[model samples]
Structure formats: structure tokens, C-alpha cells
Target: MITIQNLDKAFAKQKVLSDVTIKIADGEKVLLLGHNGAGKTTLIRCLLGEYRPDHGTVTVAGHSLAHERVAALRKIAFVPQLPPPIRFTLNELFEYAAKIGHCDIDKIRKNSIYFGLNTDAHDHKAFYKLSGGMKQKTLISIAFSRDADIFIFDEPTANLDTMGRDRFRERISADAMKEKTIIFIGHRLEELSSVVTRIIELDLGKVIRDEQA
Candidate 1:
């Protein structure tokens, strides 16, 4: 389970999130909905332990993020909207991920193939040198390779082709993911409705709507 209690965060006097409290149980597939600047990214950053809440606590799987950062983070697998600019080659990146987490290289390769990206064809290429679509696919594949308790996707299909997008939705709905807690940040509700069990909308740094799908 993941819990955010009375979360408050600000940047340079501008509040990005305020009194935001949410609890996500295991096996919940949630669609986090919001327009740009609605604090969705801020909340996600907090959950990832990239930002500390100024007035609240974040707990993942009974571990407090403030007190046990690494332990809390180890339970999550994340794919951000924009891929990071990493200079490492695919093979090197995979090696590093495996060192830090329970990363399955073969599963990563299979996932890359599922996304129409051939890992072998680009194993020696630097991540920063790949096309936008390729980078997104690689990030997704790596995230999926980890056996994590929670999966967070932020606009994960932005750079994917139409067929790739369809495949992604299918993968999210696959039985293998049925027991994991998945949070997807997306604007296309129609495309995600079939997979998401709940919808949580944010507006002006607050949750305006939250309901079952």
C-alpha cells in the first residue's frame, strides 16, 4: 500500500500541492488525470522520493519514505514522460539496473520486442543517441524488468506509434500485472479506461475528482 497524508509542497513561494491525501491499495490500477500545471508531476516526484513533502508523509509498503528512502523506492518501478538523457549504452544501463534492483535482462529484451524495439539491434548504442520512440521503449522495458510492487507511468505512450500504443494498453491489462499497483498519468481517458480501475483528477494542486472506473 501507498499513502500520502496531508501532503503539502511548494516551490519558491508557489504552492504546487496542498493538503493532498491519498491512499492506494495493492492491485489498484489508477489513472491520474490532470491538465498541465495541475501538480500531477509534483505529486509523482514526491512518490518517487525525488522531492520531500514539506508538511506530510509518504509511505510505501509500510516503509516511510523520509526514514527509509531506499527501501520505499525499491518497491516501485517508474517510467517518466520524458526519458532521461543517459550516456550509457543499453548493455551498460541494463548492467547497472541489475546491480541496484532485481532486474531481469531477458525480460527487458522481451518487453522491448513487445514494443517493436529490437534490443539486439541497439544494445551498443548510447541511450541519449536513440530516437524519442526508441528511448521511451527502452525506459518502459527497463521499468517492466524490475519485479516491483508498484508501477508508475507518466505519459508513457507519448512517443509510441499507434500500434505501439495499443500494445502498451494490452500489456497493462495482461494477467501478469493483475496483482501489482499501477498508477498511470495520462490524458487519453478512452485509451486507458479499459485497463484502469479508478480515476483520480487533480486541479489547481488539489484533487477535484476521484472515482471508480
Candidate 2:
């Protein structure tokens, strides 16, 4: 389980998150919804150990983020808001991520097909040449390849067409059904309703609502 107690954060002179507290049980699919700059991304960064909370505690699977950053990070995977703007091919990107993430290459190769990444695209095409949706798909593939217990996704369907979005959600839903905890941060509410079990809304710097979908 993941738990946050009295979490607080600030940037420059502005407070971004204040006394935020939440508990996410195992296998839960939680959606973080809000307008731009509602502190959703900041919270995710703190959870990922990329940023430090000014005060409070964050624990994931019984490990404290403040105390066990490396250990905590090993159990979580983050798909950033923007896919990396790199010059490497899709395959090369995955290969590098897998090596750094310490993921299983064979499993990643198998899952790459589900992302609609063909062997041809994987072999020689540079990431910049792929469509935006394809680049997002490749990024997601690499994130899931890590086999982390918690998966954090930021605006996962930003650039996908109708069919691509549906296909991507299908794959993610399948994974969630297998009891993976997914924390999705996005502004697209309609797209998330079908997949999210709970919705947590943030306004300014506070969690204003928490409801079951």
C-alpha cells in the first residue's frame, strides 16, 4: 500500500501542496484530476522521490520515500508528461531504458507488440520520425517493462487517435486487473471514468474531493 501523511510542498514563494494526505491500497486505480498547475505533477514527482516534500511522510509498500529513495524507486515506474525527445530508434530507446531500469528484455519485447510497435519500427526508425502517438506508446512500453508495483502515468493519452487510445487503455486495464496500482494524472476526465476506480481532485494546493467512480 502507499500512504501519504500531511504532505507539504512549496516552490519559490508559492505553496503548491499543503497538508495532503492519502492512502492508496494495492491494486487500486486512482485518478488525479484537476486543471493545469493544480499540483498533480508535483505530487507525483514527490512520490517518485524526484522531489522532496517540505514536511510529511510518504510510504510505498512499507518503505519510506524520505528514508529509502532507491529502494522505493525500484518498486515504482514513472511515465513522464512528455515523452523523451531523443534521436534513438524505438528499439534503442527501450534497450537503454531496460538496461537502466533493470527490466527483463524478453518481456519488454513481448509487450512491445501490444503497443503496436512493429519489428520494423523497433529496428531502425528514430524516435523523432515516429508519430506523437507512437512515441507515447513507446514510452509507456518502456515504463511497463520495468515490472514495477506502482505505475505513475502523466497524461498518458495526450496524443493518441481514437483507436490508439482505446487500444492503449485496453492494455492498461488488463494490467490493472492483475492487481497493479496505477496512479494516473491527467486533465481528460471522460477518458479516465471507465478505468479509474477512484478520483481525487486537487484545486490550487489542496485535495478538495475524493470520490469513488
Candidate 3:
């Protein structure tokens, strides 16, 4: 489970998140909805321990994020909204991710293949050289390959093609994934409606609505 209590965040004295409190239970499929500057990304960053909250606490799977950042992060797998500008080639990236994440490179390769990404041909190519869709596919593959208690995807399908998007939706909606704690941040709610058990909407830096779908 993930817990956030009385969370508040600000940048250069500008408040971005205010008194945000939320609880995410295990095996819940949650859709985090919000427009730009609504604090959605900030909230995610806080949850991932990228940004320390000015006030309040964040606990993930019973571990305090403030006190145990690395341990807390080990329990989550995340696919960011945009791929990072990494200098490593596909092969190097996979090896590094496998080593650091303690995940199987084979499983990541399998997932990439399942997503129609030709990792073999792209192995020697730098990650930054890949097209947006390919980068997205690789990130998705890596995230899915990891063994984590929570999976968070931010605009995961934004760069995918129609078929690629459908494939992603199918994979995430599979029965095997039904029991996982998943959080999705996307504009296209219909694409994930079938798998989302609950919806939480944030606006003006606070949660305005949260209910079962």
C-alpha cells in the first residue's frame, strides 16, 4: 500500500501541492487524472522520492520514503511520461537496468518483442537515437520486466501507434496483471477504462475527486 498524509510541496515558494492526502491499497488499479500544472507530475515525483515533501509523509508498502528512499523505491516500477536522455546503447541499457534493478534481461527482451519492438536490431544503437515510440516501448518493457509491488505509468502510450497502443492496453489489462497495484496518468481515460478500478482527479494542486469507477 502507498500512503500520503498532509502532503505539501512548493517550488521557489510557489505552492504546487497542498495538504494532499491519499491512500492506495494493494491490487488497486488507479487512474490519476489532471491537466497541466495541476500537480500530477509533482505528486508522482514526490511518491517516487525524486522530490522530498516539505511537510507530511509518504509511505510505500510500509516503508517510509523519507527514511528509506532506496528501499521504498525498490518496491515500485515506473515508466515516465518521457524517456530520459540516456547516452547508453540498447544493449548497455539493458545490462545496466538488469544489474541495478535485479531483473532478468531475457524477460525485458521478451516483453519488448511482445510489444513489437525489435531490440535485437537496435541493440547497438544509442537509446536517444531511437524514435519516440521505440523508446516508449523499451521503457514499458523494462518496467513490466521488473518485479515490483507497484507499477506507475505516466502517459505511457503517448508515443505509441494505434496497434502499439492496443497492444499496451491488452498487456496491462491481462488477467495476470489484475492483482497488481497500478497507477496510470493519461489523458485518454477510455483506453484504460476496462482495467481501472478507481479514478482520482487532481486539480489546482489538490484532489478534487476520488471514487470507484
> Which candidate gets the maximum lDDT versus the true structure?
3
In angstroms, the error of model 1 at 11 is 0.5
Ranking by lDDT: 3, 1, 2
Candidate 2 residue-pair clash tally:
0
lDDT of 1 by residue, 1-213 (tens): 999999999999999999999999999999999999899989999988899889999999989988998889987999988888999998898788777767777787788898888778899999999999889888888888898879999999988998779888888888999999999998888998888999999998899999999
Evaluated against the true structure, the overall lDDT of model 2 is 0.83
Highest TM-score against the true fold, candidate:
3
Residue 11 accuracy (lDDT) in model 3: 97
How high is the lDDT of residue 75 in model 2?
76
- Give the Cα-based TM-score of candidate 1 against the true structure: 0.96
RMSD of 1: 1.1
Give candidate 1 regions above 4 Å deviation: none
Error of 2 at 142 (Å): 1.5
Q: What C-alpha lDDT values do all the predictions have? A: 0.89, 0.83, 0.91
Write down the lDDT that model 3 would get.
0.91
Q: Note each model's CA RMSD in angstroms.
A: 1.1, 2.1, 1.0
- Candidate 3 weakest ten by summed lDDT: 171-180
Flag the better candidate by TM-score, 1 or 3: 3
Per-residue lDDT of 152-213 in model 2, one digit per residue for the tens?
Answer: 98988897777667776887768444588889988877886777899999999799999988
